[model samples]
Target: MKQLKDITVIGVALFAMFFGAGNLIFPPQLGVMSGASWMEAIMGFFTTDVSLSILAIVAVAKSGGSFYSFSSKVSPRFSIVMGIILMLILGPLLALPRTGAVSFEMGIIPLFPSIPQYVFTLVYFGMALLFVINPKGIIDKVAVYLTPLLLLALVSIIVKNMLMPDADFPLTKISNVYAYAFLEGYQTVDALGAVIFSGIILMGLKEKGYTDTSSQVKMMIKSGLVAFSIIGFVYGGLIYLGASGASSIPAGMSRTESFMALVERVFGQYGVWMVAVTVIFACFTTTVGLTTAVAEYFSELTNNKLTYRFNVITITLLSYLLANLGVEQIVLFSGPILGIVYPAILVLVILNLFDKYIHFKGIYSGVVGGTLCFSILMFICESFDSLLVVKDWLLSFPMTTFEMGWLIPAITGGLIASIIYKIKATRTI
Candidate 1:
């Protein structure tokens, strides 16, 4: 009974961390486009969003709860560089500001059309700052109370929509719906966020006397399962809700607007209120978690030269400025960056899972380096049309048709590195 209680609390905390304001906005749109193929599309999405996330948490746990430790397998220098980049993407540069942007868009803008976006952003971050500043019971409160409310709101919508299914709308078919959805799932950035957020969970477990390495890893896996279970159910239901009520969504509506349309159709005016409440709590809790995690990381990295309060204030202020850009702009800006970063992140997390068995250091550096080069080339090509020559060559590689051109290179690089490592070992002997 005691063990069950512990896992539940930890699991809810993980859920609150990952289920940001934007999370509610994305899945329904995928459902709308997916139509009859929602199941396959969602499975592909679940692979990157939920499965990779759990693997990341387990990887960090195996590394003794330090994200940097896992990355350091490649090299110390590479670890520091990757560490800074991940913090920025998962912090003020992206995810932190996104929470504020999304909260205003989904929670405040529709209800109060007249208010300036900046005003809501300021207030959103201000509230998050207060919660993070104190740092006591924030995680526990979110896990224990806030997550259930978010779940309740979503469940209510799902159940209601299922009982009285709306008229079917025409399904917009993508050539490869599953692959497209898999690529689109990159926007969630949950896999990267999981690596960043694992520190908070590890900290909680340490406080709760989970000290041994083996125990910490076990707790992380169990808690991750809890988080993913809720995420999968809610994500699927939201997708289904959007699919079932597709007719109500106007053509060319933004993802956020589409979701809101679904809610309004299902629950009428009261649905707007339901969405607002859910967005606020869900976004707010996520903001708190991200701010707390970022602040803790930089503070420790700087050895208290940058105080926790100072780091939190700095991140909050920066996020406030970015939030004013609105949700669409932030998400748009994040795409190219995440596309580049996520490939390396995936390679690192997945390889680290076999850390004990993969004794050769070359395996880490080779695969990650290969992924980084290809993903960056992909980003560059997307940014500059002149790079089409390079892009064309990369697309010739396996899985490139699916926008996953990095996979073959990662495997080949690992194999070559293993051979080199063996040759070097033989020469020394």
Candidate 2:
């Protein structure tokens, strides 16, 4: 009974942490695009957004519950590089600021259109900083207070939409529904988040006295399953709601606009406040978790040369400035950067899962390096007109059409590295 209670709390907290800004906005937009193919679209979205995220958690847990340990198998330098990148991206550079931007856009602006975004962001990050400054109690605070309200609002909206007569779903606007949804899922960035968040979860479990490695891994896996199950349900409902309203919503509506439109359609004029309540709490909990995690990470990385309190202040202030960029612009800026980083992280997460069996540590460098090189190439070719030939050649690679052009290189690189390591060992013997 006690174990169940602990898992439920940690799991709900985990869900709240991951289900912020991008998680909320992306689903309905994908539903709008996928239209009648919503099922396929939701599955594809689940494949990356929820499934990969859960896998990342398990991977980190199995690798001793710290991203540094999980990543350092590639090399200590690689670990530090990955750590800095993850913290920055998950910190002021992207995700943290996004929570504030999303909250202001969806939560504040909708209710008080005349309120300056900068003003709302100031108040928003101030509140987030209060929670994060004392990081030990963050999980309890989020799970006990914030998550339930967010869930209630979301569940109510989803249920109300379900009871309504379905609007005719227009033909899907996408060419390949699965691939489009899969790629779009990258916007959630939860997989990247999972790598960092696993440590937080482990810490929370440790606080509950789960000290041993075996027990920690078991609890972490259970907590992840519980967290992602709820995420999958909410995502599916949101996507369905978007599909139902596809014909009625405007073609060029921004994700925030479409989401607000759906809320109003569900609950009438009063839905404005409901939208405010949902977005603010959802983004609030996430901001608290992320700010705490990133602050703790950098403080420890620098051996407390950067104090946690100082890191917290810096992150909050920086996020506030970036929040003023608005949601759309922030999201646009994040895409190429996430595209380049996510594949390498994904490869690392998968390799770390089987760390006990894989004696050749060089395989980690080979696989991740290969993935990164190909991912950068893919990004380059897609970005520049002069690289059309390179882009075409990349498209010829398996799964490139699915935006997974890194897979072949990763496998080939791992094999080559493994053979080289074996030869070296034989020569030494």
Candidate 3:
């Protein structure tokens, strides 16, 4: 019974970590494009956004037993390196920028088309820095007002859109709709977020230290299951709400614009302004958590001279610069990076799981080597996307984009890693 109640707090905290305000725009727009197949789209999305996410979180808790502990399998140095890189990627480079851009796109742009975009960007980021440097209960107090207001606004949009699905078909089309939908869902990077977010869950578990490994494992699973349940509910509800957009939204609208249109259509002019404020606040909260966590990890590496406050100032300044680049740019940069990072992260987590429980392999070194190799491939692919009109010529050379180049490389990397582990373990045995 105590465990059940304890699970709720941890579950809710995990929910908040991934529920950053940037998440607001991701699903609704996805659903809008999903057309009649919104349900399929949602299923695909939940795989990355929901399923992998829960697994990552539980995997962390169950494995190395903590974030650093899990990460250490790759070597403390490698772990820290990855942590810093992830923070920067999730911080000023990608996530922070998206928050403000998304808010402006969804909340303010349509309402004031004439205003200079930079003006909004500057103001929004300025407010974000102020809040992040100083997190407090007062903000929580405001959130009490903020969450309900946000939920009501979102609900209003969903209900209205459902009442009026789009008559026109989706402008964007893709085959293997489910697979694409699932991959598209991966764009949000929330699955990666689950690993970053296990801290809160770990803290709760610390309070109930078990005398034995068996008990600890049991507790971790229970807590993880609870967290996954809550997350599943939210993801399922939001994705369904997103896909239900087919009949109502106009064909020409961009994702953010479509969301705002729904807001306006449901609540009239006032709702647009209201949503703007809500989005800015929501974005602020998420960035605070991201920046703060990065700083905390860095401080651990450097032995406290780097302080959370200093990290915030630095990250916020850089994030301000990056955020100005616009959402499309951020998305373009983030995609390939995640491809590399996600695979590396997954391999490491899986290794941690096997080593801790079964005591079977050299999980750490294999992860380190595999990540370095895979990240290079990801970078090469991303470069192709940036430089060439396309990679048709490169595809002929070897494992390329189409014809399953990526698949073969990923499988080979995993196999090589297993062999390396076996060699090391054999020597020890």
Candidate 4:
């Protein structure tokens, strides 16, 4: 009974970290765009949001180390390189900064018409820095306070909307709602967050002296299931809220903005502020976790010459500087970064799990190179309309309409690399 109780609180902390402003904003956008495929879209969203999140706990158990534990399978050098990339990708550059911006847009903006952007940015990041470095009452802080209330308010809105859905539903201009939904889920980066947070949970367990591998595995598994329930409830409610809201919000608003509008309408004045506070707190916690992890990674790599604290301060400042760039700008920048980073990370994850006969050689780099090469080509095609303007030779690849010309090159690269290693028997040498 006590063990089960421990699991509940652990799960709550996991969920709270998972439910940031992006979590709130992403789904409604999906609901709006998912159109007839809302069900499939949300289901797919669940993969990145809920399912992949749970997978993190599972991965931690299997690898028996932090997020980078799986990286050693490829080689320590590759692991460190990949881990650093994942952290920055998940941290201030994208997910962490978005948390503050999203909170301002959804929670604060409606309340005050013209709050200068800098004041909001400074205060928001300040609070995040304070709380992250000095966390209080781990589970209760998030589970009891932020996530549950957010869930309740969201559920009520969605339920009311379902009882009376918008009279007319509008479809997005983009073709293939399911694919769009998948991409929408990709944007949330919840799966990546889960991977990072699992490391946190592992550290938490290790601190409490749950050192036995078998025992730690069991604890992680149970804790992951608990996190799933929280994820499921929140995600489902947000989708419903977005669906209910589609009628009132003008089609002109971007998906992210529309979701914020939906929340404001549903909750009214006080409710909106509550949403803001919740987002700020939730996002803050996640930022701290991400910053700390990255700092620690760099610290270890440099033989602890630079302290973790220094790395945290550096990243937070750099992120704050970038915050002035605003939300849309950040996303625009992330486009190339995400394109390049995501496929490599995905390939690594796949290799980590299913590579019984496979081990990481320097050759894994070949597959990574292949994945990025293709992803980059796809990005160039998406970036420009005319081939004439595409000056760089790297951008001159033949892009197929299948939109997945990258996958072929990545696989081909991985296979060739693997075969070369097998033929040379590099491990023997």
Q: Identify the leading candidate in terms of lDDT.
A: 2
User: Residue 226, candidate 3: how far off, in angstroms?
Assistant: 5.5
Residue 195, candidate 3: Cα error in Å is 1.6
> Model 2 clash tally?
0
Expressed as tens digits, the lDDT of each residue in 9-88 for candidate 3 is 55544454456654666666776666667668778877766776767766776664556777776577777778777767
Query: Model 2, 91: alpha-carbon shift in Å?
Result: 0.3
Q: Candidate 4 overall Cα lDDT vs. reference?
A: 0.66
Candidate 4 lDDT, 1-429, residue by residue in tens: 766766776677777676676776678767766554567777777765576556655765677656667666656777777777777867768766776666666666777869976788788777656644533344445555556665555566666556653434556445776666655665565656667777666655665567888877888778778887877876776775665556667767876567667767766665566566556665665665666556666777788797766776777777777777777888787657776766666666565555564674655567777887777665775668674354344444443332334566777888888788787886688
The reply for model 2, stretches above 4 Å from the true place, is 332-334, 382-384
Between candidates 3 and 4, the TM-score winner = 4
Model 1 lDDT, residue 177, Cα? 73
lDDT of each: 0.82, 0.88, 0.62, 0.66
lDDT of 1 by residue, 21-84 (tens): 6688788988888877888778878876777788888888787788788789999889888888
| Sequence-dependent TM-score of model 1 | 0.94
TM-score ranking of the models:
2, 1, 4, 3
Q: Root-mean-square deviation of each candidate, in angstroms?
A: 2.0, 1.8, 4.7, 4.0
Error of 4 at 58 (Å): 2.8
Clashes of each: 0, 0, 11, 0
C-alpha displacement of 354 in model 1, angstroms? 1.2
Local accuracy of candidate 2 as per-residue lDDT tens digits, 171-277: 99989999899988865668888888887898899889899999999999999999999999999999998988888788799988888888888899988898898
TM-score per prediction, in order, is: 0.94, 0.95, 0.77, 0.83
